[model samples]
Target chain A: MIFYVVIFSILALLLVASGLYAIIQKDLLYAVISTGVISLILSVMFYLLQAPDVALTEAAIGVALTTVIFVITIRNTTRFEDENDNNKVK
Target chain B: MFGDYQNVVTMSVYGSSIALILIGLYGVLIKKHLMKIVIGLSVVDSGVNLMFVAVGYIKGGTAPIFSPSVIDSKPLMVDPVPQALVLTAIVIGFAVTAVALSLVIRLFKHHNTARIDQIKSLKW
Candidate 1:
C-alpha cells in the first residue's frame, strides 16, 4: 500500500513536470521529445492503474507514432522558436 | 496507514489528470508556434483519456478481462465501457493529429513560416 502510493506520487510528479517542460522548452525538438516522455510516463501510469489496454494503445500511438510524425514535420521545417519575427506582418 | 494510502491514490490520480488538462489548455491558448499548438492538442487529448480511465477505475478491482486461470469466487472488475470508449478516442485523436500536421505542412509550404500570427492570408 505504502509502496503503491510512493510510486504513484513519483510517476504523477514526473508526468506533470515533463508536461510543463514540453510546453515551455524553447527548442521544438526538445519540446516534442518531452511530450513523448509524458506519453511514456502516461502509459506506465495506465499500467499501474490496471488499464493495460489503454496503456498499450497510448504507448503505440502517443509515444511512437506522434513523435515520429512530429520529427518528420520538424525535419521539413524549423526546429526553434523564432522570437523576434514571429508576429511580424509579412 | 492503509486507509490514508487509498485516499491518496484516488485523489492523486484524478488530480493529476485535471492538472494535465489545465496545463494542456494553457499551452493551446498561449502558444503561438503551429507545432507547439499541435503538441498542446495532443497533451489535451492524453489528459482527457487519462481522466476517462481514472473515473472508470474501481478500488481493489482487477482488469475486466476474464481468464480461467485467474478465476476467483468473487470478482471485482473495473468498468469496461470507458476503456472501450477511450480506445476509440485515442484512434480518432491520432487521425486528427495526422490531418493537423498535414495542414501545417501545407501552410509552411505556402507561407514559408510555421507561426500562426504570420500566416494571415485567410484573415479578413
Candidate 2:
C-alpha cells in the first residue's frame, strides 16, 4: 500500500545516490565504503521484494566479502585517486 | 492516488537499476584508476542483479517458501526461478570480482602504479 510505495521510493533513491557516490568519490576508501552501502540497501530491497534467499546472499557477499576485498586492494595501493599526471599524458 | 499503483512503484526499481548500470559504465569507460574500474564493474553487477530480482516480483504474491499455513498460495508466490538464478549470479560475481582485483593487484605491483594510463608495457 502507501507504506510499500514510500519505502520503495526511498530505497531506490538511496541506492542510486550511493552508486553515484562510489563512482565519483575521490578517495578510494570512501568509494569502497559507498559500494558496501549500496549492497546493504540492495539486500534490504531484496527482502522487501520477497526474496529472502537473495537478501541473505547479498548481505553476506556484497556487504561483507566484496567490500573487504576492495578495501584490502586499496590498502595495498594508493588511497586517493591521483588525476594530474595520469590525465596529462592522455 | 497513482494510476496502476503497483506498476508505478516497481517502475522505480527498473529506472534506478538502469541508472546504476549507466553510472557504472561511466566509471568503467572514463575513470583512469584501476580500482575505480573494478568498482564500476561491481556496481554494474549489482544493478543487473537488482533488475533481475525486480523483474520476478508478482503482485499480491508471497515469498516462495513452504509451510503448513500457506499451502493454498502456490500460485501467488513471487517467481523463485529468478531468485535461484540471481543467487548463483551473486556468487559468480564475487568470484569474478576477486579474480579481477587480484589481477589489478598484480598489474599495480608490476608497474608500481594503479592508474591504467601509466601501464603501457602490455599495450600494442
Candidate 3:
C-alpha cells in the first residue's frame, strides 16, 4: 500500500516535469523526445497499477513507433530558421 | 474515504491520471505544432486507459481461474473487460497514429514547411 503511494507520487511528478519540458523546449526535436519519455513513464506507471495490457501497447506503439515517426519528420524538415538575419543587419 | 484497499489504490490512480490528462489537454489546446498535437493525443489515451484498468481491480482478489481446490467456491477476481477494451483501443490508436503521420508527411511534401501557420494554401 505504501509502495503504491510512493510510486504514484513519483510517476505523477515525472509526468508533470516531462510535460513542462516538452512545452518549454526550444528545439522541436527535443520536445518530441521529452514527449516520448512521458509516454514511457506512463507505461511503467500502468504496469505498477496492474494494467499490463495498456503498458504493452504504450511501449510498442507510443514510445517506439511514435518516436520513430517524429524523428523521421524532424529529419526531413529543417530544425530552425537561419538566425543570421540579425548578423546581416549589423 | 473508501476504506477498502483496492478503492484507495483506484482513487489514487484516478487522481494522478486526471492530472496527466489535464496537462495533455492543455498541450493540445495551446500547441500549434502538428507533432505536438499527436503527442498530446497519446497522453490523453494513457490517462483514459489507466482509469479503465483501475476500475477493474478488486480487493484481495486473484485472477479468475478454475482449480480443483477452489472449483466450487466463489472467486473474487479482477474484471477482464477493461483489459479486452484496452487491447482494442491500443490497436485503434496505432492505426490512428499511422494515418496521422501519413497526413503529416503529405502536408510536408506539398508545402515546404511543417509549421501550422506557414501552410496556408487554404486560407483566403
Candidate 4:
C-alpha cells in the first residue's frame, strides 16, 4: 500500500518535471528529446497503473515514431529556435 | 489526505495528467515555433490518453483478457471499453501527428521558415 503510494508520487513528479522542461527548453532538438522522456515516463506510469497495452502503444508511437519524425523534420530545417534570426535586428 | 491509499493514488494520477494538459496548453499558446506547437499538441494527446486510462482503472482488478485457465473469474477484470477506445485513439493520434508534420513541411517549403509568426501567407 505505502509502496504504491510512494511509487505513484515519484512518477507523477517526474512526469510534470519533464513536461515543464520540454516546454521551456530553448533548443528545438532538446525540447523534442525532453518530450520523448515525458512519453517514456508516461509509458512506465501506464504500466504501473495496470495498462500494458497502452504502455506498449505509447512506447512504440510516442517515443520511437514521433521522435523519428521530429528528427527528420529538424534535419530538413533549422535545429535551434534562434538559429536564423539571431543576427537580425528587431 | 494521503491516508486513504487508493483514493490518493487515483487523485494524484489524474492531477498530474491535468497538469500535463495545462502545461501543453501553455506551450501551444505561448510557443512561436511550429514544431514546438506540434510537440505541445502531442503532449496534450498524451495527457488525454492518461486521463482516459486513469478514469477507467479499477482497484484490485486484473486485465480484461480471458484465458482458458481463468475463465471462471469474470468479476476481476477491469473495464475493457476504455482500453479499446484508447487503442483506437492512439492510432488516430499517430496519424494526426504524421499529417500535421507533413503540413508543417509544406508550410516551411512555401514560406521558407518554420516560425509561425513569419508565415504570413494567409494573414489578413
Error of 4 at A10 (Å): 1.1
CA lDDT of each candidate?
A: 0.86, 0.90, 0.70, 0.84
TM-score of chain B of each: 0.91, 0.90, 0.81, 0.89
Give the winner by lDDT: 1 or 3.
1
- Reference-based TM-score of each model: 0.92, 0.92, 0.78, 0.91
Task: List residue ranges in candidate 2 displaced over 4 A.
Answer: A83-90, B1-4, B72-75
What CAPRI class is candidate 2? medium
lDDT of each residue in A7-86, candidate 4, tens digit only: 88888898899889888887788888988898898888888767889889999998999888988887776677765553
lDDT of 3: 0.70
Which digits, one per residue and each the tens of the lDDT, describe model 4 over residues B1-124? 2466867787679988999999999999998888889889989988998999888888787777777888885667677788888888988988998899898888877787888888776842
Per-candidate interface DockQ score: 0.63, 0.63, 0.36, 0.60
**Which scores greater on DockQ, model 1 or model 3?**
1
| Candidate 2 lDDT, B13-100, residue by residue in tens | 8988998899999999999999999999999999999999999988777889988876775557899999999999999999999999
Where is the poorest 10-residue window by lDDT in model 1 chain B?
B1-10
Cα-based lDDT at residue B114, candidate 1: 89
Indicate the docking level reached by candidate 1. medium
lDDT of 1 by residue, B1-124 (tens): 2466877777678877888899899999998899999989998888899999998988788888889866765588888899999989988998999899998888888888889888788942
Q: Candidate 1, after superposition: displacement of residue A38 in Å?
A: 1.0
Please list the residue runs of candidate 3 whose C-alpha ends up more than 4 Å from where it truly belongs after superposition: A80-90, B1-12, B63-75
